[model samples]
Every structure is written in C-alpha cells, then in structure tokens.
Target: MASKKRIGLYFGTFNPIHIGHLTIANYMVEFSDLDEVWMVVTPHNPHKKKSTLLDDHHRLAMVRIALEDYPKLKASNIEFGLEQPNYTVNTLILLEEKHPDFDFCLIMGEDNLKSFHKWKNYEVILERYSLYVYPRVSQGTIETQFNNHPHIHKVNAPIMELSSTFIRKSIQEGKNIRPMLPETVWKYIDEMNFYK
Candidate 1:
C-alpha cells in the first residue's frame, strides 16, 4: 500500500494572517518532512481570552485570503465544526477520525512549549503524535522541563517577533498595519472596516 501523506497542523486564532505565520508555514513545507501545512483556525483558545478575538468566520476568511497563493499551505475551519473552546487534543482526535489517509503531525512554537503542560490532555498528544517546534523571538530555548524526545523535533527557523496583539493594537491606534499583514488580508480588513 502507498504511504499516506504527512500533514502538519498549526493551530492558532489567526486574528489576522500575517507574514510571520506564512513564513513559518512556508519554512516547514520547504525544509521539513511535512508534506503540507494546515493552518487550523481555533475559534476559541481555552487558555486565551476571547473578548478581543475577531469572529471565527472573519478569522477564517482572512486566513484563507492570506494563504491562497501557497499550494502546500491550507486554511482549515475544522475547529468550527467541533465543540466550543477548541482544544488542541480534541481537534487532533477529530482530524484523525475524519481523515485516516493523512498522517497528522502537530506544529507549535517554542513559546507554546513553555506552557504545554497546561493544555488539555497534553500528555496524550505528546505521546501519540510527532511535534515540530519552531523558534520564537525572545523565547530563549526550550524549557528544561521537556526532554529531547525523538517525537519532538526542533525546526531551524528564524525567530519572528510579530504578533496578532501588536497588529490589532496598531490598527486600532490608526497606525500603518500594511507591513504586518498579507496585502489581501489587509485589504479585506480595510474593506470590511474590521479591527477598528
């Protein structure tokens, strides 16, 4: 039988899809063994406050617009079909069940590794799936708490300091946000009068 495709799942709110997000996804596809990278838009992050988050639909739309040109990158709304407060573990379970042909791997940032234990059923995720962790600006190194397990691989990527919070704040403050977001997404945000 033919081997199944390897898919890396990058979970985030994607309040607005930015260059940092694309750069990481592109790096994973070009440098890593991952066959494709799926940007999974989580409507609700359990650990984060939802008050400032853009609507789930809006976030999904922007992600789609930003990632449209990349063949190996995709925008997924899988979390939307599932239950609320989309936990990473639950999304993994659902994806595995629905798409048995695609071998799923988890992709996260070094910063996320700091509080990974706080995630729901994190142990199961670490044990059952392979993790590709990228470096984040000012995050230092991986915490000593985590071992250099074979399942967890460190991807050699540049540290990126951009963040959705900063982008949103700049938009609200009437500052130029063109540099932080994809042109299509920036246009969409402006046309829709979002984040104002």
Candidate 2:
C-alpha cells in the first residue's frame, strides 16, 4: 500500500454532476490525506428509484465533463459493468482485485453514517477500508456509533445545501440551475435537452 497512490472512491448517482459534487471530490484530494479521488458514477442506487435518474451514459458523461478541469479527480463507470444493484462492498472488492497498487478509501457524506449499518456487509467495509466523510446540507448531527472507530475520518470539505433533485426540479420548472452546476455541464444539459 505504501508504494501505491491513496485513492478515495467518491460514489454517487450524480444524476447530473453539480458543483457541490466536484467541490467535495476536489476538497478531498486537495486537503485530505487522499492522493486522488475517483467519482464512481453509479448506474442505479439501491436507495433511489430508477425512474428519477438520468441514463447511466448521460450521468457518466456529465461526470466526465465536470471532472475535465480536475486532474487528480477521475470519473469512473466501474459500477456500470458490475452486477445489478451494485453493492459498495462488491465494488470495493473488485477494485482491489483489479488495482492492487492502489489503497482505496470510501468517501461519503456524514449523513450516510447514520444508516451505515443498513448497508450490506457494512462491517467488512468498515474493517477493510477507511471512510472519509464530509458534511452535507440537511445531514445534521453525525451519529456517534463510529466516533471511536479509527477507520472513519471526518473531512472538512465544503458543504453545499444543493441536491440533484432540486436541480432537476429547477430545470423542469423552468428555473435557473446554472448556478448549481459547472458551465460545461450546464451547456451539455442544455444541448442534450436533459431534465426537461
């Protein structure tokens, strides 16, 4: 692990990549102990309904566009080719097998910690890798259960109250969503007539 780069896996549906998402990933690479951050774009989140999300390719494209300016940050479609309802543990396992030279860490919001136990093989994930958690809007008061756990670390990344659902609604309602997203992504969305 000492010879490889410390990579943080930032998983999300990224319905349409927003500045908030990029902010967290960039902050992790720039401020945290992580050497790089990969935006693992999920095709479908078990917790979310499939109909509400954009196609996997579109979401992947948006992530790619949003990450163009960030060299240390990458957009990954690792979950797209994986099994149905791609589980985090499975993704991590595959990543480890595929890239033995990388030390992978899980990156998520503090809110997720509140329901960490609900995830499949949560204990194994906690025991095998580190978790870099950042604050999110509406995700108040992180749970104390993992406070003493050495594997979980709190990251002081910028927290944006914005959400993809809000952005999509804004777009659907004919309100401006430009402020919440990168210019390139906004342009692409407009060109593709997405979320309309």
Task: Specify the highest-lDDT model's number.
Answer: 2
Error of 2 at 187 (Å): 0.5
Q: Which ten residues in a row have the lowest lDDT in candidate 2?
A: 136-145
> Per-residue lDDT for 75-188 in model 2, tens only?
999998886867899999999999988999999887888788889999999999999989866545555668868999889888777889899999999998798999999999
RMSD per candidate (Å) reads: 2.1, 2.0
At residue 86, candidate 2 shows an lDDT of 74
Q: For candidate 1, lDDT tens digit of each residue in 81-111?
A: 7766567888889999999999999999988
Task: Mark the 10 consecutive residues where model 1 has the least summed lDDT.
Answer: 137-146
In candidate 2, stretches whose alpha carbon ends up further than 4 angstroms from where it belongs are 45-49, 139-143
> Clash pairs of candidate 1?
none
